[model samples]
Structure formats: structure tokens, C-alpha cells
Target: MIGRRGFLKFFGSSIVGLMTLGGYAFGYEPVVRLSIARYQLTPPGWTPGLKLRIVALADFHACTPWMTADRIASICARANDLGGDIIVLLGDYTSGTDFVTGHVDHRVWAAELAALKAPLGVHAIVGNHDWWHDATAQKRGAGPTFSHKALADVGIPVYSNRSARLEKDGYGFWLAGVEDQLALRRSVRWKRQFTTGLDDLSGTLAQVNDVAPVILLAHEPDIFPTVPSRVSLTLSGHTHGGQVRVFGWSPYLPSRYGDRYVYGHIVEENRHIIVSGGLGCSVAPVRVGVPPEIVVIDLG
Candidate 1:
């Protein structure tokens, strides 16, 4: 048995250690670590030695203490400096929590994001948070627009269950974007709530030619399994790399597939998915091992 003094000393040391770690996770980690993840993708039909650079930015969740409008602007500026041929914006531009409603002026965000420079142009897709925040109020009567006007107002085309062909230097590929899978909430009550919307994968694919390579933009990685093998790559950001990873594992990953598609590159049966750690946090304003990131994918 341990003496009283010894037990007290041990308990005190443990408390101090936990506090220090908490401070690091909630403070320094969220603001300091912005990583650039590089990947090489060789989609089907690509000519040998030919490559394309795609930069992906996701989940800004702006207006928070760590991810303010100024921080968002800075992040965009940094992405521009990366010299990517195409830039893809995966959604969740605002935070959502009881304390913070995850609201940001779309017009103002558009101005800052418009500064992004990409040779192939910038394209975007909507996330669940955008739908929750009702970012598509202008087109609500018509259908779910998901920040379409806001992004388009600044020259960024928003794709919802649609596909677009991008060609450059005699090479081209098909890009498709789908609506948020979790956006069709009919009620605010937790137990009564259910999703009514479903992503139209077939509708989006119908616009693309089968001969060319295809890339997809989806807010949630849970849609990966349903994606056809014809899609060369899929980019997503909803998990936020579990927000806080302990020993390289996250317990709070919000996905049907759990940590299988949490973050970084995941390859399954020749199809690829890259889930960005993202630029902001939701629910909780802290990040542990999984720092925010801007993904830079080089395809050859």
C-alpha cells in the first residue's frame, strides 16, 4: 500500500500533466499547425509523365476564435502561393455549435475566396453545415442550392449533383459534385430528425463522358463506398480528422465507416479518397494530433 503523501503527490502530477496537454490541444495546436499534404495520383488513361496539381481546401468554419475571417483570408493566400492547376473548395465554411451558430457573411467570404488563383479555376460543393445554416435561401423555393449564388457571385461555380469538364494543355478530366447526404433534416428534435435528401450520383455521372478520367467532390467521406470505380479520385472534408486524435486514433469520428475514411489518402479497390483535416473545428474549438491542413494533390 502507498502512503497518503505519496498518493497525493502522484495524483497532483497527473492532474498537472493533463492540464498542460489540454492547453496545448486547445490553444497552440489549433493555431500553429497548418500542414500541406502532398499526394500523387495516376488516374486511368493518363499519359505517362503527365501530371496535374490540385489543391483542396475544406471546412473553414469561419468566425471562430482560431479560424476568423482574417485567418481564412491568410489561408486562401497561402493556397494561391502553392501554384496548383486546380483548386477545389469542399464546404462547411461556417461553424455550428450551441454557443456559436456557425454564421458568416457569404458575400464577405466570397470576396476573400475570390482571390484564390488556379489555372483550371476554382470549384466548390456544399456541406451539411451550409444547408443547416440555410446558405441557399435565394434558391430554396427552386431546390437545394447550397451556397450556389454566394460562390458564383465571386466567380466560383458551385456544383450540386452535376458534372463539369475541365480541359487544359490538350488534357482534360470530368469533375463532379454531389449534394450533402445529411442535409435533409425535417425536424429540429433529435429523436424525430431524419435525413430526406440523397445524393444523385447517377445524375451527376450522366453529364460526363465515359472515356475521360473523373474526379468527385463530396462533403462527407461516408459516400465513398457507393461511388463507382470509374471515379479516379474523391475529395472530402467533413470528418475534420476526428478533430482530436489520441495516439493516432480518434474516438469521435462522425462517419458510418468510422475511422476508415477519417483523414489523408485512402485507397480501396483502385478508387481513391482524400479527406482533408480541414481548416476549422466544430462543436469543440480544439484540435489535438490532427492539425488543420491544405491538401496539395499532384496527379500524374
Candidate 2:
């Protein structure tokens, strides 16, 4: 029923709009706007005058076009410049998924990450992707992945359901790393075989004193509830801030609790959780309202 001129106008406008959006998603949004999220925390056993800075880098899905080894090296350089007391690396180092796969020298990537310097040292934990791809390759009866070994070679201990005590200038606290929850879920399978893994929360906490202020590192924010109130703060990633938030909502959030723990700082009673938007994309390589970021938590 439409006239020729009107139909042409409408079609042309639609094409133009799609092109613009495509450009932003595929180009500008993916490359630009590396954000730094800062939070101030006053946990249980804090001396009023002393301040500690912890920088968290999460979901570095390396080897993608937008997230190259050079790009990761640059990110480490930027993080080093921040002068954080401790640097925490949340997982997802490789880009092996149904939608996309990337290959890079694990040694090279590890070397770049090894360059990062912090007083309290750099610590890390694995993510679901690491489990899915067997980044440690413990599934095939093979040993840990080259990437994991490389990280260890650089003195960055990647904890799995373990606790490490860190002290500086007579002030001390516990840093606990919980294995990825999805690592144990039977649904996370490959080639018709279940990737039976383990994430013992109680085992990780058992080494720590109940009254000691603890900072937990977990890849998925859903574990926030399982964490006892004795733990002061928890840092996490894996949702990618919903990856493509439109008007503060996303259709494809990779979370078990929907959008509840999508991104940013979340507070519950005496506990706190900071979920980073993370450094790379999955499935489709694009971002809308959500931007990749490095989170800095300052505790006093």
C-alpha cells in the first residue's frame, strides 16, 4: 500500500541505522573506553590511618582480534602504573568458545602478565572458560595448561580453593581463592563426558580464622551468597556486565541469578562484592552500554 518514494525512504533509513549500530558494536565500543572502577571499603579489622589498594583484572579473554597479546601487555602496563598494593587476576585467559576460538602462545601471554608489579604481589584464580577448555588440561589426564604453569613461573600463584595470608607494615589479612562453581557442574561437559571438577568453599575458608578480615576471589558473583558474613569483601567477574547492556538491561546475561549480580559494587549486610565488567567479549564480540574495566578497591 505504500508509495515507491515512501518505501525507499523508509528502507534507506533502516539500513543507515543498522550500519551505524553495527559500526559502534564492531569497532568503537569494543576498542575504546577502558574504564577504571574505584571503590572504598571499610572492612572489619581496619586501621583508620592505613590504606591498601587492590586492583582487580578480570575476564581477559585473550587472543581475540580486539584482545591481542599486545593489548594485554598494554593493560598490564596501565595496571602497574596505578601503584596498587595488590593485583588480583580473575580468570578467562583464553578465547575458546562455541562462537569463537583463538590461539596464542601461552608463554608469551604469561610473560606479559608476569611484568605486572605490586607490593602484596599478583594473585589469580581460574574461570569457567578455563575449565571448559581445560586450560589446566587436568581433564585429559594431562597436567596443568602452559598458561597456568607460565603464570606460576612468574611467581603469581593461582589458588584453587586455598587461602594465602598477606601482611605488610604490621597490618595483615587473608586472601582466599575459590574455584569456579561451574567447574563442578555436570552440565559443563565436552564430547559427551562430564568435566567433574571441584570447588570446596568450606575447604578454602577452613584455613582462615573466623574473625580475620578476608578478601575472597571468585570468578562468578553467584557465590557471593555462599560466602559467610565473616568474609569482608569478595571480588568477581564472568558476567561481563551483561556484555551488551541496553538501557541498563541485557538479553544474554551469562549468570545463574539473572541480572542481580551483573556488574559494579554490590553490598549485603556486612559483606561486599565487586564484579568487574571485565576486559573482553564472548559469543558476539560487541558491547553497548557496558564497558570493559579494571576495578580498584581501597580498604582502610
Question: Best candidate, TM-score-wise?
Answer: 1
Consecutive 10-residue window with the lowest summed lDDT within model 1: 135-144
- Tens digits of per-residue lDDT for model 2, 1-300: 999999999999999999999888867776666888889879765555657899999988776576778889888989998879999999888773344445656677778889899998999998877666653364453335555676898778998889988886777789999877777334433343554445678999999964557889999898888888778888999999998998888999887689889998888776788999998887778888887788888998
Weakest ten-residue segment in model 2 by summed lDDT? 184-193
Error of 1 at 261 (Å): 1.2
The whole-model lDDT of each prediction reads: 0.82, 0.81
Query: What are the runs in model 1 whose C-alpha is more than 4 Å off?
Result: 1-5, 47-49, 101-103, 135-146, 188-193
Off by over 4 Å in 2: 1-3, 44-47, 96-102, 135-143, 184-197
Candidate 2 residue pairs that clash: 136-145
lDDT of 1 by residue, 175-293 (tens): 89998887755655433256655578888988987567889999999989999888888999999999999898886988988889999999998788999999888788888988889
Report the number of the highest-lDDT candidate.
1
Backbone clash pairs in model 2 (N, Cα, C under 3 Å; residues 3+ apart or in different chains), count? 1
